[model samples]
Structure formats: C-alpha cells, structure tokens
Target: MIKFELKDLEVFYGDFQALKGIDMKIPANEITAFIGPSGCGKTTFLKCLNRMNDLVEGCRVYGQVTLDGEDIYNDYDVNLLRKRVGMVFQKPLPFKMSIYDNIAFGPRTHGIRSKSALDEIVEQSLTQATLWDEVKDRLNMDALSFSGGQQQRICIARALAVRPEVLLMDEPTSALDPISTGKIEEVVMELKKKYSIVIVTHNMQQAVRISDKTAFFLLGEVIEFGDTEKLFSVPKDKRTEEYITGRFG
Candidate 1:
C-alpha cells in the first residue's frame, strides 16, 4: 500500500532549486530512509510530505504530492494534514510545560477536552515511544529536565499523541548517545507496525538498521531507491556505491 506518492516534484527556495524532479512511492507501515550528503534534497523532500516547506518564505513547490490518493498540496486543509502526519525534529524540543501537557497538547488543540481521554492519550503515546515506564510517575515534571535521549523520546511521544498515521523524523537520534540512539531505533522499528515512517538520516548505518527501504539522494535527485539490504550490499548506481563505501559524499 502506498502512503505517499510524489511525481515530478520540484521545490524552489526563491531562485535556488532545492529539489528537482523527485519521484517516489512511500509504502504504508514501513520505515523509508532518505540518505544523502548535506545540501542534498533529503530534508527538503521529507518536509514536502506534510507540506512543512510551505512555512518557508519564497519556497515554491511544483509537482504532485499525494497522501493516500489525496492531494496534500491542492485544496487540502494544512492544519488537518499536519495532524494526520506528524513530525519530529533533529533536536529534542520538549515544551517548557510538564511532560503530560506536552503529550496532551495536540489533543487539546484538536478540541479533545475530556480529562480521562487526554490522560489515556498521554499514557498510550508515551508507551508507544517506549518512555512510559521511565516517566509514568513524572508526568507532571517539566519536560525539559529529562536527559537528551529521554527528551527525544518525549518528542516522539508528543508526535504520536495526535494519533498520526504517518511520522516524519529528521535525524531523530543524531544528537543522542549511542544507548539513546539504540533506544530510539527500537522505538522507530516498533512504530512501523502502526505508522508509516519517513526519516532523513546522515547516519547510513542507522538507515540500514531501521529502514525497510532506502532512497539515496544526490544533487537534488534520487540516485537509487530500493530495498535497504540490496541498495547497501549491491547498489545499481555507481554514485550510490561510492557514497556507501565512503569514497565521497
């Protein structure tokens, strides 16, 4: 099942073209990793999925980007689209409020006012992100007080709280320690059972470990995209092989 389909996608930040002719079908209930060097269109492409790039001034997108057969950029309600597709950033940006409030924020914004319902969402979201056990009793504590890794998981939980069908993670564990990275990887893997996950990662090994499919982007184009194992072990494109072998970015 295809969760997202992009055809002839191009993104321009004023006169500078950030992405050119991107075409890909992201599968449902799987982790798809976009791997490339800095300045490649990986993050730009990720942002397009949920129309996050629309927030940028002078950023224009031309082409078709559909989510579950609906045009996300054509007459779609941007706020609702965002609720259906959540995003987590590179850094752990927990709100200054309590942990419970952070998780309940989205639901509250969506008009879920029942205290019991909000409590359930907070617990379930945290559990899904694999942080419930550690912070179940600390729900009222300030979310910023946690360690970096825990903070990242809290961010993930906050994204999940809205009951999003798709989750976009941008280098979600890049700032964490190895142990925290491993924990986030495990949580992401588990999430694929219920959510279609798209991640932009500079860490190729992390991509290999968590993603089912990998898209290798270079110079604003996808050089290769296929099964994670096949793409890494036997790349069809020479540029992909070189990038994977550390010959060049």
Candidate 2:
C-alpha cells in the first residue's frame, strides 16, 4: 500500500524554486530516508509531505501530494491532516507541562477526555517511543528535567499518542550523543511495523543503519533511489558513489 504519493512536486520560497518536479511513492509501514548536502531541498521536500512549509510567508507549492490516495492540498482540513501525519523536528520541543501531560496533550485536544483512556494511550505511546521504563515512575515531573535524548523521546511519544499513520522526522538524532542516537535508531526500527516513516538526515551512516530505502537528492533533484544495500554498496549514479565514499559532498 502506498501511504504517500508526490507527483511533479515543486516548492518555492517566493521566486526561488526549492524542489523541481520531484516524484516518489512512499510505501506503507516502512522507513524512507532522504539524504543530500545542505540546501538541496531534502528538508523542503519533507516539509511538503505534511504542509509544514505553508507556515512560512510567501512559500508556495505546485504539484500534487496525496496521503492515503487523498489529495492533501485540496479541500482537506490541515489540522486533521496533521493529526494523521505527525512530525518530529530536529530539536525536541516539549510543552511546559508535566511529563504525563506532555504525552497526553494531543489526545486531550483531539477529544479524549476520560482519565483511564488517556492513561492507556499515554502508556502505549511512551512504550512505543521507548521511554516508558525510564520515566514511568516520574510521569508528573517536568519534561525539562530530563536529558536531551529523553526529551526527544518524549516528543516522539507525544507524536505517537495521536495514533498517526505517517511519522515525519527531520534530523531527529542530530543533537544527541551516540547512545541516545542508538536508542532512537532502535525505536525507529520498531516504529516501521506500525507506521510509515519518512526521515531527512545528513548522517549517511545513520541513514544506512536505520532505513530500508534511501533517496539521494542533489540540488533539489532526486539523483537516485533504491534499496539501502544496493544504493550504498553499488550505486548506479556516480554522484551517489562520490557522495557516499566522501569523495565530495
């Protein structure tokens, strides 16, 4: 099943085109990583998946992007669509509320009122995020009290609480230590069974380690895309080989 389809997708910040007629199909319950050098529109293309770029002034998108075979850009509620397609940023931005409240915020806003129901959802989300045992007894504490990695996991739990079908992560492990990065990689691997994950990462090693499919982007164009093993070991594109072998970024 195709979870997302981008057809002739182009994005612009005013007159400057960031993406140039890109097309791709994201499969259901798998992890797809976007990798490229800086300013290559990897993040720009990721933002269009959930319409996150619309918040930027004068940013416009031209092309068809569909989620679950539905045109997300046409006659659809952005708020509801976001709930179905959750996003995690480069940094973890937890609410000022307690740890439990942080995870419960989305469910509450989406009309889950009962305490028992919220508790169940919170537990499930935290477990899925791989932060349950670490903070299980301290649910009422401040989210700020945790370390950077823990905070990121809390943010992931918050995204999961809403039961999103697609999870979009932009450099999710960029700021954490190696151990934290490993933990996140483990959680991401686990998440692919239940949710389709699309990630943008500059860390080629992490991308190779975690993703089943990889898309190589260069200068706002998709240079190549294939299974992780084939793309990393025997790239069809010379540019991909050069980028992967550190000959040139």
lDDT of each: 0.96, 0.94
Q: Flag regions of model 1 displaced more than 4 Å.
A: none
lDDT of 1 by residue, 142-218 (tens): 99999999999999999999999999999998999999999999999999999999999999999999999999999
- Model 2 over residues 23-68: C-alpha lDDT tens digits? 9999899999999999999999989988999899999999999998
> Can you tell me which runs of candidate 2 are displaced by over 4 Å?
none
Candidate 2 has an lDDT of 0.94
Residue 151, model 1: lDDT of: 98
Clashing pairs in 1: none
